[model samples]
Target: MSESAAPGALEQVRTFLNTWWVPNDTRAPEDRLPALLADPAAWQADLPAFAFPGREDAPGMAELRAALRAALGEARPVALGPWLARHPLRAELSADPDRPPLALVPEDGTAGGTILAAVAEAVRAGQWARLKACPDCSWVFYDHSRNGSRRWCVMNPGGSESRGCGSIAKVKAYRERRRITS
Candidate 1:
């Protein structure tokens, strides 16, 4: 709940979803596990509130990561009507023209509710295919590209970057094609 809560909501959701790499391979590194297992209290304290009020069963890191992975694995367009109906969202309409008034207040145990709302909001804003999980790294990212055709996570997405297997896989395909042609 910082000074920029409203505008920062979507970014906060994006940041939260990017927490773990839901490994696509057996050798997947645990970028999110060590810290979470090491210290639960501190980890929860560090989570972003986004634009929503907090709720009970706020979900441990593992659960939250699982939901994100599950959604990506479904690999389909978000149909938020049913999801929204399941959760009791507390929000108010806005009178201001330049601002969005969808402030979500969850009653309880709707840890994944924020994400669904964010997805709905993004889709409502015409960002139809924003969420993407890299097939190689298993890292989730928002596709900010104009055409929404981004297919891989960043090669280096902050400290201690992943091997960018998505890019590596592309190169492997190219090499195989050359071998066949040669």
Candidate 2:
């Protein structure tokens, strides 16, 4: 995994989910998947962890992205069950006794199946529940806080950059409080 990514295969899920547009971010305010679908090489470059879907699989990928976004936004894993059912995983036995016995692999070569498999693996690892969409900007992020109580995406954890929905939400709440007080 790269330095920017979450640990283990959860990074794939995080990256996939974060492809959705955020309104106030410096990045383009548009869903990135469309451009990626138009150019498979760019998609592969960005998401090297998963299989790049063929042009024919673009619709399935889009549907999967929507389903994933909805599931994360609502904090409901059940929302993904039907979409995930279309991309079943195959269990591969592991050799080491200390590790998990079976590893879930994508049943097909499409990006949707690979990401869905990653989601299943993340769920099994107890990390899927931590992946959430920021209520303020709808940006998907993995909450790595110790208590798992993080509610917004931090723009600058160490004052590195002022670009997160958390900062914007705090400002809005502060303004609202001031207005009420006045």
Task: Find the candidate with the highest lDDT and give its number.
Answer: 2
Off by over 4 Å in 1: 1-7, 22-26, 29-41, 44-46, 50-64, 73-86, 95-99, 102-104, 107-110, 155-162
Candidate 1: which pairs clash? none
* Best-fitting candidate, scored by TM-score: 2
Q: Candidate 1's residue-wise lDDT over 88-163, tens digit each?
A: 5666577878657665454444546666556555555654346667777666666666776777775433334455
What is the Å distance of residue 77 in model 2 from its true position?
Answer: 0.9
TM-score of each: 0.63, 0.83
- Residues 60-102, candidate 2: write the lDDT tens digits: 8878888887776343478777866777788989989965788
